[model samples]
Target chain A: MSEIINVSAIAKVEKEKIRKRIESFRSNGKATPTLATVLVGEDPGSVYYMDMQKKVLESLGGTMLKLTLTEDVSEQELLSTIGDLNNDDKVHGIMILFPLPKHIDEHKVAMKISPSKDIDGVNPMNIGLLASTSGGIAPCTPSSVVEILKDTLGELKGKHAVIIGRSNIVGKPLIQLLLREHMTVTVCHSRTRDLKEVARSGEVLISAMGRPKMITEEYVGDGAVVIDVGTSELDGKITGDCDLESVMKKASLVTKVPGGVGTLTTTILMRTLVDLYEKSES
Target chain B: MSEIINVSAIAKVEKEKIRKRIESFRSNGKATPTLATVLVGEDPGSVYYMDMQKKVLESLGGTMLKLTLTEDVSEQELLSTIGDLNNDDKVHGIMILFPLPKHIDEHKVAMKISPSKDIDGVNPMNIGLLASTSGGIAPCTPSSVVEILKDTLGELKGKHAVIIGRSNIVGKPLIQLLLREHMTVTVCHSRTRDLKEVARSGEVLISAMGRPKMITEEYVGDGAVVIDVGTSELDGKITGDCDLESVMKKASLVTKVPGGVGTLTTTILMRTLVDLYEKSES
Candidate 1:
């Protein structure tokens, strides 16, 4: 018989610790950690995410500064605004909301922000840090995924983790992080010949292919821990890459769609802000 | 049964093409390739390598400029020398030989070279380029390994490769390169448990650990393509990480100790210099 690992319980414990840390920092005379959210266009999902993030930070005794720019803003203007925030001591961390206007070079805008103030860790400097294995800020989504896994699995030293999806966001960075933790990681993408065979090799499975219920019972072995980082709207509701009904039976632990990684992501953003604030003082 | 793949014949054909390319560039006036080698001490192995590299470059019509610094050159002096090389218009690429005197900070010195002239690809800027997936130059040894794999396998998408050893020079950079090629890469180190099991899982096995003949027949899967990147002196003779006798039996394709990656590394270095030279002119 395999023991069932409760992912929600682990996430709760992490969230509680983060909440207490924020409170302690607030009480200590340190400036309340602030995250500046910059949006280039009218993205409904981005707006909703910003609002939810603002509420979460507020709950944790942190503050959010929103900067909305029109879609017509020139590239130079956007860069200038980012440069200003970089120089401002008040802004502890900066996250430029994605889905920018088609005309703008997103990579240029990302490079404009100082790496020290980059809460999203999408900047080239932080990416280099992750690749170099020297340790610095890491991409938030993948970093959070590892944190969740570590909290549940303890040390990941010898574990075999197979990742579905080879996007720069999740698969690439996650491979590097897992390597740092000494886990043997395999990444499969759309080009993979045998997806189920690859998934069955994993003691830990991470699905980030953005497909609704892509991972079925065939992809999972008994006692496997599955982390679904995909969120797709199906039938007017949120669904994940893993088929919960079938995968849950085979998985020792599993993360649900709306309640799983999405919740931890914003919490990680708050933590990034706090980390930046502390580094500034030190 | 899985189909057996023969890699050595393909590698030889590719090697011949690469050799011809080097020869054509050497005789042609269009690309004047040059590599500058900087050596600080008088180590016997380093001297032999430096001499052999010079001969190889000259044979390929590339010029090699040797700069021998004193054993006790100050950090400032070393920096200034590298600065001169950075500013030299004739020098297309610069490489600081390994095992500098104990007084100098190797990382600081490596960082000082202009990224465009960093033929070795150890500079932070080039590292950043590789990390960002923007296709920048890479360290010669790992770069050669990837080139060999791709030349033999023909686009290594979704291939499972496991690399032993986590040295900055090989393991980390190789992961970045393999990820770029869309191969799922796993890196294992001294701390890794069940090392043989990990090595056996790889369809492509890269042994970079310095221990001579460390990878045995048991660590290799049938028909696995093996690349031995280690060069160690065992009983006054050069030996590799893979046990040639046993590994050759299990491996459908294998690179021997002296004739394997070592032969290709300096050739790759010359190729990198030619690339930098062309980029500079453009």
Candidate 2:
């Protein structure tokens, strides 16, 4: 049987490190690492992500300021709210939950977030910095994937990594990170022909497509490292992109959903918050 | 014989369109579209590029402002010059020639150019915007590749494109552009194992790694559309990454050095200048 990677244990260790850092900040008479989350309209997914962020930040002895707005919040009002957050010294990091009311322009909102405070890496400057291998932080989900891969496989140089998504949040940033690590990266999406053939080429395969249990045994190459980043609710259960049971039989190692990437994602978010806080101080 | 794309003819046609636009602007009593270029030190290649830019802009009835600084120019001094250009009412666009001395930080220089006037798309904000498929402009080289591909193959959807470089200026941005066009992209670089095998997989192959004629006929798949973006001097003659004479025999369509992507690249730069000028007015 292939080893099922325990991501929760990894997250737990990361949380302990965050807790220690926060404690040190408190002892040193420094302000708590505070994250300001701006949420508009109650899209369940966005709301859920915000709550997870809050729980993780607060649990680490950090502060989370939730600025909840009505679904009909005007673009001006949203921008002004973010402008206020940008000026607020107490807020070290800022994250704006997406899918704001259709009338509001998401791109404009993304730009309004100050780069230093954009812990989620939504700001265009931050995204560009990541792309250029310059000074920008990356979004949490992609960062978690890199962290997991590095932790499992120490030397990634010359390794072939196939990422099965091309999203700005996950797939795109993951490509840059892997390339920086000296690995060959192939990005596949819905339009990709021979998806299974291409997917089988990766020594390390990452699935971020939101399809549940789509990547089955045939997609798995013998002894390949599989990472599942998709989360979808099916029959009152959380399912990942990979059919874990079938994949485990052929894979050397795999990360399960709900407890795998998700657990580590929140931890990375907290880490970014602390890092932003430290940067702000320096 | 494989079809050699007439990039010079295409550039001429585009230049005519630009000339007409400038005439229209002149007829309407508008200021001439002007581009400000910053060049530090006497790097022959950078100087040659600036001269080419000047020649092209002038040919299109546009103004080209050259800002020359010594090799020992400080970071603050260079940024101040950009700031002055940013405030100049006559300057519609800005381009900074790279390799800005070891002492001066290039990334900081990139960030200093205002996004609206960053015609070359050197600003991190623009880079990020392009990556996110948002409102940012792309650099000329990558844009030229897209133009050539779209011109050759009407619909790029489902095409397998393999880019053989990972530079922020070319390979990285090109991935986003191709992905936006619904093509599957695989990026292979120095650390990519089985480089030739990976390169042979592209239905459309693009080489931007400045190694002189490293990609031979073996790297070309049957009837592939090959694009050579690399230009390196070998024995006093400029050469490209692909062994063009051999690749031309195998590729159904190919772009040659000196007269291929480079010609279109300069034309696109002038196009971006006029675009920025129009954008500034609106």
Candidate 3:
């Protein structure tokens, strides 16, 4: 039986530490560490994510400010709201929930947020900083994967990490993070030829392709560490990028979809809020 | 004999096209495309690069503004200089010559250059923009590699490209460029295990690690296209990252050190200047 990497349990422990730290800061009369989220056109996924973030933050004595906007909100209006949050002394970190309606320019909206306050790492400076290995705050989903791997396998050095996505959000940033850990990283995307052959070669494989059950037994090498970063809905059931049943047989360790990386992201989001807050203080 | 990729000849062809375009614009009484360069503590290498840039720009009827500073220039002084250039209407592009004295923070210096005028693509925004594959304008050296390969191979789609350096200036940005071309890219560095094996895997191999003759015949696969992005002084002679004499025997197509990627860079710089100029106009 494969060792199912307990992502939530690990996140729970980390959350406990954050809770104590937040309390310490609060008792010492420091401004409460706050995460302000801007949501445009309510998405079930986005709502769930925000709910998770709010729960994770408030439970640790941190504050969550959720500003839900209509789908038809003009780009100027959204940018104005973000501008306000950028200057707000009480807002330590700001997250813009994505897919901000077709008419709105998402990249422009992302860039408008100050890099220091961008806990989601949406700002180009944040991604560039991550690429250049200059700063700490990385995009949450990628960081969640890193945290999970760090918990399960102490040191990632020399491991061949093959990521099955080339997204700005996950695969690209994850390469930088894994490279920092001294691991050999390879990124495979939609155009990658002989995908299964490439997938089987990874000592540590991460799938973030956002396809349901795309990775089967053939993709997992014997005793390889597998991380699924993809989440989707199939027939009203949650599905990940990998086939958990088949992957479970050959994988030495694997992260299930809902219970794994998905759970850790909101927790990492909370940690990022605290980090951004502490960074502002320092 | 290996097929020698003539980077200089190709650049000349591209330059001619740019020259005609510039001439047409000049005939219409448009402002001459201008490039402003910031040089600190003039190194011999940097001097040569500047000279080449000047020649390239003028040959195409563009103007070059060269500002030389002393070694002990304060960071504030440099920032002030960049600020002036950023606001200069005549300056369409700015290139900060390498090694900005020991005092000035390089990243800070890079960020100071306005992205619109940053022809070198050193700003985090430019790098971020390149990585996100939104709009073009990549860092010159990396873009030069893509141009050479695109010219030689016609299409990089589905080709396996392996980069031998992880520098922010080279390997990281190159990944985005190649990925944009739909090529499968794998990056290897000093810590990479089975170095020879990794290099051998590249159908299109790029050596940018700045090591002289490090990639021997053992590193070159059967009929691989080798791109050497390294330059070093070995025995009072210019040498590239790969063992040219040896790799030439194995590589189906190869780029020579002096006449290879280096020659194309100045032309690319010129293109970037014109690009920034045109971007401003549009």
Candidate 4:
């Protein structure tokens, strides 16, 4: 039987370490780091996610400032609110929660978030800096996956890493992280021909395609290390990209759906806030 | 014998098109486009390249403004000079010539260049936008290479494009451009293991590693399209990363040095300026 990896366990330990570091900042006479999240229109999923994020930050001894706006809020009003938080000395990080209303231009709003306070790494300036050099905050979910991989596998240098998806939030940013580790990286997407052959070729496989149970036994090789970043809703049930039952049997290591990358994202988001806060201060 | 692709021939035609377009803008009572180039030191190669850029812009109905600086200029002074050009209404595009003195922080200076005026696309915001979405100006060299390939190869939709460098200038941005065309792209750099195997695996091979004659016949496959972006100064002579004679024999098409992507870069810079100007005006 292959190794069933526990990413949440690793994240728990890392989260405590971040909390300890936050304490050091506090002891040094610095203000406690604050995260400001902007939510446009209260979707059930986004609200739930924001609440979970708030709880995670509180547990880590950080503050979560929720800025809830109506769906019909003008772009200028939204930008004005975000500008206020950016100038707030106590605010260290800002995240615009996903699924902003259709009327609001998401791209324009994302750009308005200050790079220093851009904890989610959605700003092009922050994202560009992350890819251009080793600078800037990495996107939360992918950063967590990479942190987990680093902890699980000591040296990723020269490993053949294959990613399924070319999303800015996940696959694209993850490619930059893996490349920084000197790994041979290949990104396969929907238009990619011979997906199965490409997936089987990698020693480290990452799937962020958001398709439920898309990666089957046919896509995995013997003893491949698989990281599933997919969260698709099917019949009101959440599942990952990889087929847990089959991937566990075929792969040497696997992260399960509900308890794997998903669980760590909140903690990772909080950790990123602390890191960005420290960086901005220094 | 394989086809010897004349990239300069294609570039010449495109340059004329841009010149004609500039004439139309002139007739419309608009001011001529101007390029502002910043030179920090008196390096011969940098001077030569800057002169080439100047002549290209002038030849294509544009103006070039050279701002020479002392080698010992402080970072603040350099940024101050850049800030002036950014606010200058006549300056449509700005390019900071490479190889600044060791004392200056290149990254900080690059960040200071305004994205709208950044013709070379050195700013991380532009690079990141190019990568993250289908928006923003692409770096000249890579954008030229993609345009040449698009002109030569009718549809790059399903082609396997491989790049042998991960530099922000050529390889990284080039990967984004190719990916936008729906090609299966793989990027390999100096740390890539089994370089020869990786080179032979792709149908479209690009070498931008800046190592003279690094890619020989053994690294190429039959009927592959080879684009060399390397320009290494060896024994006071310029040569590409590809062993051109050997690669030409193996590949179906090849872009030769001195007349390949390099020739199209200046024209593309002017084109990007016109594009940005139009975008800003609109």
Candidate 5:
């Protein structure tokens, strides 16, 4: 029987490290690292996510500054807010919540975030860092995948990894990280002609295509480690790209939709904030 | 018998397109795109490359601004020169001759070039664009790979591709591009275990690891399309990462060392210069 990889245990350990780091920073009177979460429009999902993240930061002894803007917030107004945050030394990290109003140019707003304070690591600087393999902050989702894989797989050197989806946030950056680890990594997306054949070849499979339950048993090789970064609401419940019920049966380790990567993502964000703070001071 | 992929033909077509585009831009009275080639030292290869590229641009009615600096040029001076070039509106692109002086921080210098003027597409902004998949100039070698793949494969959707090497210049960004094309892309490096198995599964195999003749017939499948992006001097002879004499027999299509991607790289740079000029004006 293949061993089950339970991330909750590892996540708890990492969380403690994050919490302790935050506590040390707080006790040192080095201002608590602060993240500014800018939300435009009222999406319940966005709100819930923001609140949960804020709480997570609070629990870790970090500060969360929530800036709420109306759905009709002009592009100029948003840009100004980001500019203001960029100048604020108190703000170590700034994240403009995704799914911005249609009228807003997301890329422009992203560009405004200071590369130094870009804890969410979605800014162009971080993206460049990933592309060049030089040191820079990493995008949260992909960084989390790297951390989890390292924890579960020990060393990724020479491992064959196949990624489903090529979204900027996950697949592309994840490929960069895997390359750094010296893993044989493959990225498959919508344009892919033979998905199953490609997936079956992986020692590691990462599903982040935003599709719900698309990966099945046929796509998995025996003893393959599966990480599902996809989050979709199916039947009023959150689900991942991999159909865990069947995949879990064939895989050595599989991350479930809800309790798997999603749980670790925000935690990683908090850790990134502390790291950024330390980096800034150094 | 598998048909040999003639990359030179594809490269010639692209070169012709660039030549035509430059001519068209010049005739339209558009700012004839100019690329300033900055050389820090007296490296023969660097000098040759710069002169060759300048000739290519000049033939197309574009201008080349040559800045030849002493080998002992200070970092501050180099940076200031880059700054000056950035402010020069007529200089649409800047190409820094590679292998700078030992004391210089190449990455910092590379980052200093304005993204709008980075015709070689080595700037952080372009690298960030590569990571984001939102579209930006890509490193010339990798971008050429993408261009060649599209011409040969029709559309790479769902193809299994493996890249050997993880250098910032090639492997990381190439993976991102391949992923963008909807191909299953894998990166394999020296630390990888079972490298042969990984290489054999790829419908497309790209060797960029700078190692000379590292990929042999044993490392490839029966009909894999091979792209060798490596340029190494072995015993005073230029060669690629693939053992072409043998691997060519196995590959359905193969790119030759000096005549393949390398020949197309400079033309792509010219294309990027024109592209930058167009983007800036638009």
Candidate 6:
């Protein structure tokens, strides 16, 4: 049986560290760090995700200023709201929930977020810094993956890491992070020819392709560390890319779906909020 | 026997296109596009590189504003120079020659360049744009590599491309570019295990690691398209990462060092100048 890694266990320890940091800020008479979250077109998933984040930030002594816009909100209106939050001294970090209405140019809105306040790391400047120098606020999902990998693998140098996916949010940034740790990374996407052969070669394999239960034991190597960043709804439950039971038979360790990368994402967001807050203060 | 690719043949064709574009700009009563090159400390290599670019731009009917600074120039002084160029209306693009000085922070200087005028694509915003959306002005070297690949292969989809080296300028950005072409990309570095084996897996192998003639025939897969982006000085001559004679025995195609990626780099620089100039005009 594979050692099933639960992110809640990791998040528990990280929560303690975040609490202490928040306490330090309070002791220093600094105002609580604030995250201004902009949501357009109330997608149920986005709504649930934001609600979960609100609870997480409150638990850690941070503030989430939720701004809700209708589905028909103008692009200029959304940008204006982002500008307001950007200028507001109370806002320490800013996050714009993904999947905005089709009419709104997502890239334009993303580019508008100040790098200093870009907690989710959607800003091009932050993304570029992550690529060019591996120094910047990385996207929360990718950052969570690195945190989990660090907690699990310790030293990532010289490892052949194969990632299944080429997403801007997860796979791409993760490649940069792993490369920074001196890992040789191979990114296999939909266009990859021999997916199984390439996937099996990784000492460390990460799947973020969002295809539910697509990766099986056949795709895994012996004693490989598997990280599933894929989240899909299958049979009304959150599912990951890996076939857990099948993958367990071959892998040494595999992260659980619902509580794996998803669980730590909130904790990492709070950590980023603290980081942006500190940067603003400095 | 392998076909050796020469960039001059490709550049000759591209130069005609540039010439006509310049003619169109002049016909419309637009002032010639100008590239402001900031050169600090008289490094022979950098000076030579800048002079070549100057000649290339002049050939394309563009202007080169050569800004020379002394060796002992302060960081603030260099940044101030970049700031002035950023605001200059006549300056369509700004390029800072490498190896500024041991004392100056290169990253800081790179960040100071405006993304709009960052012709070499060193600015974090541009880098982020490339990584995130594949919609930014990329670095000249990586852009040159893409030009060669596209010119040689025509369509890059689904091919396995293995790149050696993970420099900010070449490897990282090239991975993004190749990935944008829907090619499965793998990056190897000094820390990569079984470098030759990993390198041999690619149908298209690119060497940007500045180790002179490090890639041998054993590293090249049969009929693999090889692009040598590595340029190092060997016995007072420019050398590439490939053992050309040995690689030629197995590879279907190979690029020459001095006349390979280097020749097209100037054309691409002029191309980027035209792009930035056009953007500024619009």
The TM-score leader among the candidates is 3
Better of 1 and 6 by lDDT: 6
- Tens digit of lDDT per residue, candidate 5, span A1-282? 445566678678878999898888778888988999999999988999899989988988889999999999999999999999999988889988898999998888888889888877777877887668457778788888988999988988878888887776787778777877877777777777678888888899998987899888999999999998999999999988988788877799888878888778888888888888888778
Model 1 in CAPRI terms: which quality? medium
Segments in model 2 whose C-alpha atoms lie over 4 Å from true places:
none
Please provide, for model 1 over A1-282, each residue's C-alpha lDDT reduced to its tens digit, 9 standing for 90 to 100: 333345556556766777787788778877888899998888999999999889988888888999999989999999999999999998999989887998999889877889889888777667766677465577678987898888888989888888888776787788778888888777788867677987888889999998998899899977899999998999999999988888887888888888888767877778778888889878
Put down candidate 6 lDDT per residue, B160-223, tens digits, no spaces.
Answer: 9999999988998899899999999999999999998999999999999899988999999999
lDDT of 4 by residue, B133-194 (tens): 78877889998888888888889887778799999888888878888998888888878788
Q: Using Cα atoms with residue i matched to residue i, what is each candidate's TM-score against the true structure? A: 0.91, 0.96, 0.98, 0.96, 0.95, 0.96
List, residue by residue over B1-282, the lDDT tens digit for candidate 3.
688998989898989988987898789888889999888987998988888889889999999999999989999999999999999898999999987687789988998999889898888887877777577468889989999999999978988888988888888889888988988888888888887887787899999988898889999989999999999998998889988889988999999888899988888888888888888877
Over B1-282, each residue of candidate 5 has an lDDT whose tens digit, in order, gives: 555567778767877887788788778777778889999989999999989988878876788999999999999999999999999888888888889999999888889999878877677778887678568677788888988889988978878888888777787778767767767677788887888888898899999988899889899898999999999999999999988888977888888887888877877777788788888778
DockQ of each: 0.50, 0.85, 0.70, 0.70, 0.73, 0.89
Looking at candidate 1 chain A, the ten consecutive residues that score lowest on lDDT are: A1-10
DockQ measured for candidate 3:
0.70
Structure candidate 1, residue pairs in collision:
none
In candidate 4, which residue pairs clash? none
Candidate 3, residue B253: Cα displacement in angstroms equals: 1.0
Clashing pairs in 3: none
- Error in Å for residue A218 of model 1: 1.3
Better model by DockQ: candidate 4 vs candidate 5? 5
lDDT by residue for model 6 over A163-276, one digit each (tens)?
Answer: 999888889888888898899999999989889999999999999999999999999999999999999999999999999999998999999888799999999999999988
Q: In model 5, which regions exceed 4 Å deviation?
A: A2-4, B2-5
- Is candidate 1 or 5 superior in DockQ? 5
- For each candidate, report what fraction of the true interface contacts it reproduces: 0.42, 0.91, 0.53, 0.60, 0.85, 0.97
Identify the runs in model 3 with alpha carbons over 4 angstroms from their true place: none
Model 5 C-alpha lDDT versus the unseen true structure = 0.84
CAPRI verdict on model 2? high
Candidate closer to the true structure by TM-score (higher is better), 3 or 6: 3
